[model samples]
Target: MNNLLDSFSNFSYRNKNFIFLSFLILPLLWLGIVYLGSLLIFLGHSFFHLDGFTGQIVYEFSFKTLIELFSSPANIDILIRTVALAACVTIGSAIIGFPIAYYMAKFTSPKVKIFLFIAIMLPLWSSYLVRVYSWKLILAKEGIINWFFEKLNLEWLLDTILSTPVIGGPSLSISYIGMFLVFTYIWLPFMILPIQASLERVPNSLINASHDLGANKRQTFYKIILPLALPGIIAGSIFTFSLTLGDYIIPYIIGTSKFFIGQAVYTHQGTAGNIPLAAAFSLVPIVVMVVYIYIAKRMGAFNAL
Candidate 1:
């Protein structure tokens, strides 16, 4: 048995076609088990109808749940809001992360890199729930920001935040600011690493050459570095945007009860006991992610990098 196994291992490695085939097929195996299987299971669940009276799903073929999901005005609103939130978070992460990644790649000393990297990564090692819950504490009345403002005599900022009327009333508690901050904080490192990698790979000689040609800082950034880093920027944005879209915990912990699509799905599956609708609702994030990835592909983001 040992001789046979050793012979096959040698034969497999020696055969280039077999090796290439294995490379191609391994990913399919992964896709088969993960994505395709999950999607089929979801589609199967979509056929199952829920009993409103008993709050259990019945294994019956129906489109009623799907229709109801689409027809509802609240569902539409939630979907739109979730997309808008994701867009804002993506843009915010890009803007903030670019500077940090650029500074780290271009200027930060090697001696300090280890310490700064640890500091940057410390938040990720901590409990996600603990961090998110802290946001609630900070955003709630008598929170740190409010306390700081009060101490600094910046009453106007507080008044502005607390006064902005939304669906019902004051916006501070359910304000979009809290949601954006948490999203940006959680995903900033993802954005930074990619951009930093791209920026570090950028030849210093090119920047010097541009400078020699009398290009200013902003001119060089836009003309040379920005174009190269665009791929990483888009890549980071995709991850941040997609993750924020499906985020159930962060908004639930930090923001108000106003429905996000993720919350809607959570309610349907867990609380409302509408498995089919939840399954249908689950498609929202998947489709949006696919669309964003497609757009990235069209931009030739991979090849350009």
Candidate 2:
């Protein structure tokens, strides 16, 4: 036993590559075989068609499922809606999160920074469903929001917003507007942290140099700050965008009866028992994320991540 232990220790001491590979081998195998294998299997389903009359999946591989996915108007609408919502959520997150991130990164004292960090992350420490449900209550017609509007005599403004076409519904809790607000709130931390990280990496010397060169704040921000922060913004967008694309719960709970990609996937897979269609629908986000990542790579967003 001692000899075996000595030999093992000697082998590890002599071969760093072996030690490195020993640490990595299990995880690599798990990723390659388990995670990736499952994904490939799931995606394989997209090529198979369902026998509509018999209601069983026909395992013979073909493009019929994919064709049906794209050819259907309802399916197309769901795809478009999901993509649009993801884009809007990403943009909204960036707009709202950037200033807060900038403040945290550039202006806060260490103590204040810690406090703000805690505040930003606090929601994440709780149950996601709980936070979502809380928002549902908050956005409901009889919720505090409506009550506050009534107290302030801004009920007309509230009514005006709730009456707007496409986005409007009987109440904020059941509208796209509310869903947007919830998505932004849920994903805001993801946006803020990355931007703050990127901003933190920006040297104070650059800003000083810009000012030394007689550049105004506007010029410095536009030229120096914005460019440096672009990578972080893109990184955050990747998170917010991909998350919004895949999330079923938020849209299911908050939004109108109209379907998002995730909801479509869930409904097709379970209730409808249309696994092929569900698998095909699930691939939409994967394709979108692949494209998004490609674009982000061109813009050097991976550096920020």
Q: Candidate 1 at residue 22, lDDT?
A: 79
TM-score (C-alpha, index-matched) for candidate 1: 0.83
Per-residue lDDT tens digits of candidate 2, residues 185-228? 99989999889999999999999999999999999999999999
lDDT by residue (145-261, candidate 1, tens digit) is: 878988999978778765666522254457777787888888777777777777887899999999999999999999999998988888787788888888888878767778887
- Model 2 weakest lDDT span, ten residues long: 119-128
Q: Give all TM-scores, in the order shown.
A: 0.83, 0.95
Model 2, residue 188: distance off in Å is: 0.5
Q: Which model scores highest in lDDT?
A: 2
Off by over 4 Å in 2: 17-22
Relative to the unseen true structure, what is the Cα RMSD of model 2?
A: 1.6
Q: How many backbone clashes does candidate 1 have?
A: 0
